[model samples]
Target chain A: MSKKELIVREEILGSNKKVAAEIRGKMEAAGVLVVNLLSSPGSGKTTLLERIVETLKPTHPLAVIEGDIETERDADRIRRKGVPAWQITTGGACHLEAKMVGKLLPEIPAETKFLFIENVGNLVCPAGYDLGENLRCVLLSAPEGDDKPKKYPKAFATADCLIITKSDLIPYLPFDLEKAGNEALDLNPRLRIFVTSALKGRGIAELARYFIESRVNMIQHQRHA
Target chain B: MHELSIVASLFEILEAKARENQATKIVRVRLKVGKLAGVVPEFLQTAFDSYKQDTIAAASHLEIEEVPLKVRCRKCTAEIEKEDFVLVCPSCGSTDLEILEGMELLLDKIDLEI
Candidate 1:
């Protein structure tokens, strides 16, 4: 029996990356800032997103694509806040693929300045896929404990920013802010961090401001380059 | 699990490559997966075994090379290898470190018979 060795060096996720780049190109041409939000189930991602939508809708046109294993619940919640929302039911897939997100881009409002793609509530699988977003944010609620950064290092390392949500519950939880923040910093030194609580409206304004400023900065950088 | 999806993607790549080379069957697939890539090798193998049936890779073998996490200390310029996720520099104990290696999931090569 004769065997042949073929040196085929290719990426397993090449198709996904290609689609992600195409999505990024489309978003750039439309002048919309896309942000992919990642977190564990019950990590307050929806609550924080509701706050963001409420605060930014008047000033900036916004849209949302909600990903879930099986539901239109999150999308409906965003729609009630007066923003256009689309739901992608993964049906059993733990994470959203770039191709799936690309298909829904046309449904988004053309004038939308900010488009938030709330990934299925999974830290592990979502971290491996890029959805062609301008920013990637990972949220860890105080109730989830501070060891999440250490346990899910890939999520923290791949994120552009880290959000510590449900900070209002810090007093009742054993979560240490310093430890969590430090662990995330160790994984990614350049990660922008925000401590927020949607219930008290604490740090919501700052978070909203960050999005605005980040969009402006990206536009400026693109212009200069 | 996500491993199943990853295996599906792998099969797609294998099929395309086999078609390009006009190969009748795939013999072995070699992959490089880093420690920080967040994939369990055992799960990936199991997924491959279940999905390879009736495909060109039905009788193929999968070999995964686990790459260790490596980092460079910003302060001392020392390159360190770590088994854990902690990014501290062993020499200086500084948290200022840059990841040089790890976080790679690549399909390196495939052996085939025409």
Candidate 2:
């Protein structure tokens, strides 16, 4: 056997990108605004989604795709809100791949205007995988500390928006609002920041409005294009 | 860990490459993993060692070269290198930045006993 060095240059997640592109094309053709929410465990992704469902359901149709390591609890929570929800149990995987999401693309409600993908509650793994969403928002709850942006820079750096959740707990916690926001902005200067408290209903309306306006703008932009 | 997931895929590419090259066994595998590639190299090496057993790469040694974060300024068109994620261009201080490097997760080459 001859010893030879062979060059085999290949991108690792190139296949995933193709899958993500297909998903994006399908959602775009359907005129659905897909938003992917990512954060650590107990960052209130489900709570925020539930609130968003209540706010948007009366006017526009919405659907959800929940990703978790196990359990359909999140999907169940969204289902209780009367919106269509699909739960993707990753079994033992750390993140939801585009292939996993693509498998459920046909089941998405046809009349859905907005589709929310609540990514697996992991700050590290989920951020690296693209699920073909129009927007990627990362949540950092006040109780999780203000140092997360620097510690887990990829999540904040790649996020189109940063939501500082649990704002109501600021009085009882040592979380510095400006520090967290500043650190996130340092990693992603163009990130749209929002301080929200689901219990207090603060900033929820503005966020919901932003989503509505974004979908409208996207549709209009596509029309012009 | 996700490294296990990545290593599995790596083996797929390795097997295909080895077959295409008509290699009897893989001796050394070379990879270029960027700092921003979102993979822990140690974990990946460990996973590779675990998965290489009984395969064509059973006797192979995994070699990983880490690439650092590098970006280009959209405003001033300057390239900058950093140890970690930096939002703006250091020279122009422009927030309009484009990533030029440091996101690579490439299987560059492999040494095979053909």
For candidate 1, write residues A1-225 as lDDT tens digits.
Answer: 456897766778888989999998888778899999999999989899999999999999999999999989999999999899999999999999999999998788878899999999998999999999999999999999998898999999989999999999999989999999999988877889999999999889999999999889878877887
| lDDT, candidate 1, at A162 | 96
lDDT of 1 by residue, B1-114 (tens): 598998899888899888988889998999999998889999999999999999999999999999999999989999989988877788998878888878778899999988
Per-residue CA lDDT of model 2 for B17-63, tens digit only, reads: 88998999999999999888888999999999999999999999999
- DockQ, computed on Cα atoms, for candidate 2: 0.77
For residue B33, give model 2's deviation from the true position in Å. Answer: 1.1
- Model 2 per-residue lDDT at B90: 77
Compose the digit string of candidate 2's lDDT tens values, residues A1-225: 689989888977767778998998888889999899999999999998888899999999999999998999999999999999999998988888899989998888799999999998999988778889889999999999999998998889889899989999999999999999999998999999999999899999999998998898878888898
Count of residue pairs whose backbone atoms collide, per candidate: 0, 0
Off by over 4 Å in 2: none
